[model samples]
Target: MKKKKFLLIVLSLLVLFAGFTLTKSFLVSSKQPAPVPTSVVINEEKAIQNFSKALTYKTISFQEREKFDLKEFDKFIAFLKDSYPNVHEKLDLEMVNDYGLVFKWIGSQSNKKPIGLTSHYDVVPVLSGTESNWENDPFSGAIKDGFIWGRGTLDDKIGVIGILEAAEYLLTEGFTPSRDIYFMFGFDEEIGGDLGAKAIAEKLKQRGIQFDFVLDEGGAIVENMVPGVEQPVGVVGISEKGSATATLSIIGSGGHSSQPKDRTNIGRIASAISKLEETQFDGKLRGPGNDLFEFVAPEMNFGMKYVFANKLLFKPIIEQILLKEPATAALIRTTIAPTIFQAGEQYNALPEEASAIINLRLMPGDSLEDVKEFIVNTIDDGEITVTVTGTEASSISSTEGPQFEAIQQAARNVYNDSIIAPYLMFAGSDAKHYDSISDNTYRFLPVQISSDDLNRMHGTNEHISIKNYINAIKFYIEIMKVTNQQ
Candidate 1:
């Protein structure tokens, strides 16, 4: 009897385990088929060679506007014309702001709004002491260990080359777009893009040229980007946080060291900063965070899927867990960080005035007025004055419609197994300049890179794998074909 009871218990456990496995498999297989590309073939070596050669030019953006070397910019353009002869001959090219280049490929029909693709050519300056950190000369155009090394490999230049390669290849194959396609390249994106993308946007707006969508550089494929997910992740920026600078200042009477009041200028400023830190912007999972889970939920394991699939019940708990990490916490709320501070001269004397500069990244619904009010209420010190200067957050673009689906389809076509999802970009990009004329604007970089490679983007030893560069080119071609089909 004892032996029979043990056997029955073991059999029951086995049945339950099998049922769980079957149910999990069913959920995973329920996902819809991803859009597959008609064809994908690109010469990886040739693309790498072209990218390496493009990196030879030093088109750096300096804080002082006069320090810009137009000669190098001219060289970069000349190189493009020489390398992509078919593109130069087939498409109409125009120069704005002397350095910004716009290429228009006319389509069979003119009724539909045009699609715009943009990237910047200029790069940030290489600091003097960081040169030694590079494995090879930063501008040597060196191909080492299956990667093309340089300064602009992962920044905006890859977007420029990848787009041109697709256009040139399509032109060779006698493919013409059904709707107008505009390839806009900016030169001074690193220095705020005032002279490049912003100028181009204003010019296009004046001519009543509106775009169905605008795609620019912002996010890329990252490994372990999310906490629990093991697959490679791709983030598409549907909205970007607003950047603003706030100055807090306090003034008091200067006096000798021995005779001090309870509240000095420095003390007041310090106390205000402490209060602001204690009372940070509200961090709750909303907006882009919610959108991101919708796309990835179907691909997750049962435990993760259950939480995401039934988010209404688990949202508060999930958000509370996310709030524990600072980086993830920023996704749901505005952030405040004191960037610069100024105060007294000598230890013996009290300072008359003290000031601090705070950098704030505003969320979608938050306004400049809301930020000011929050600061005032939190500190509650009338003697301390505050002032703010910057643009409000850009409007959020739609994740629905053929526009977003097209982007997702194109990404899946190139990156076969990866999950493509939408998230809010924490940093600023040139896409903001097009918000006025574009109903949907997305920022995505089509390349598989590790977190280390991501760090190298604006840092030394910046490079891209030969395979990734070819994939990027193929992605652009696939996007063009998909857009035309729609």
Candidate 2:
């Protein structure tokens, strides 16, 4: 009788587990994007040629303001005028802060709020020694092996040229938009956009101009990064991680080489840093992280779907999986990178002061104050002083809104079969500055790039495929057509 009772209980538990698993496998999908065909014809050869020429200008954004080449910027502007005569003749162009280019394509409906498309023309300075590593000269803008090889090819001159190409084509087709469209090209985005986008946003804000939505570069069509989604997934950044720098420092006696106290300043600082690194902030899969899985789970295989679909019940398990990989891990929590460590000049002498700078990419839920608290608490050392400074994460944009849908629809139109989902941007971009003036600011370049190509964005051998460039132009044209129709 006792054995029978135990067997009955076990059977009941197994049945309950089976029921839960069965229900979890069938996941609910987030959004079903209807097919929208684009008939816009891209002058492929000319588009590639213009991008190649734009790359040769070397509109490099240097940290020091004096290093900016105004002559090159002027030449790029002239090139834009020479290439897109219709855009120059039709749109009212205004130069903000001398070099920041703003073009307004006035629409028939003046009352409708304007949509701003922004991208930076400037590229990061290539490391001195690494320039030789490029197959073609970094500044040559050589079109070789089906790629426009150069610095600005991917980091964003494509955006500037792509937008113009689309607008120019639309003008040639005699298509007048129902809503006003603005193109803002920033020159100083590589450093911080202080004098470029910041100035543009401020000038527009002061003039009482508000944007319906703004699009800038952030996420791209990533392959193999998102698990279970076989087709390339286009990630549109609805919000970005906050960038913060925390300097942990300690000042103590500069001791002699012969004898010293048990714990020197350098040693103490090192220990604190070790503790902070080892005791990293607990990774939590909520906000954008959770939302990302929510969007992708339905498209996942049966097993993966079963795990993510039951997110509420198995959140800990999901977070554990995401935390295992560095790239996926960044999507969930704040990242800590110890960049600079300074202690001693000579080998023998114990330095008086020691400091280390930890750069942190903060999650939307984590604030600057919250990050400081975590570091202080983690280090748990009274001697070490921690100072944190950076801008907070921008407000989360709604994925359910028309603004995001327009972006998703545009990418879907170009890359017909790719899965379009919204995720938080891990890097900083000029889009963050426009948050105040626009109802929603989205970051998507609409170009399909591989993981290797992603690494080359701010690194050496940066290039964009001729196919991707033309597709980007088509995507921009599709975006204009999809949105603003009465």
Q: What tens-digit string does per-residue lDDT give for candidate 2 at 362-405?
A: 98878999999999998889889999999888888888878888
- How many steric clashes between backbone atoms does each model show? 0, 0
- The Cα local distance difference test for each model comes to 0.87, 0.88
Q: What is the TM-score of each candidate against the true structure?
A: 0.93, 0.97
* lDDT tens per residue, model 1, 419-468: 78889898888999999888889999999998899888889888888888
Q: Model 1 lDDT vs. the true structure?
A: 0.87
Candidate 1 residues lying further than 4 Å off, grouped into runs, are: 1-38
RMSD of 1: 5.1
* Model 1, residue pairs in steric clash: none
Q: Each model's RMSD to truth, in Å? A: 5.1, 1.5
The alpha-carbon root-mean-square deviation between model 2 and the true structure, to one decimal in Å, is 1.5
Which one is best on lDDT?
2
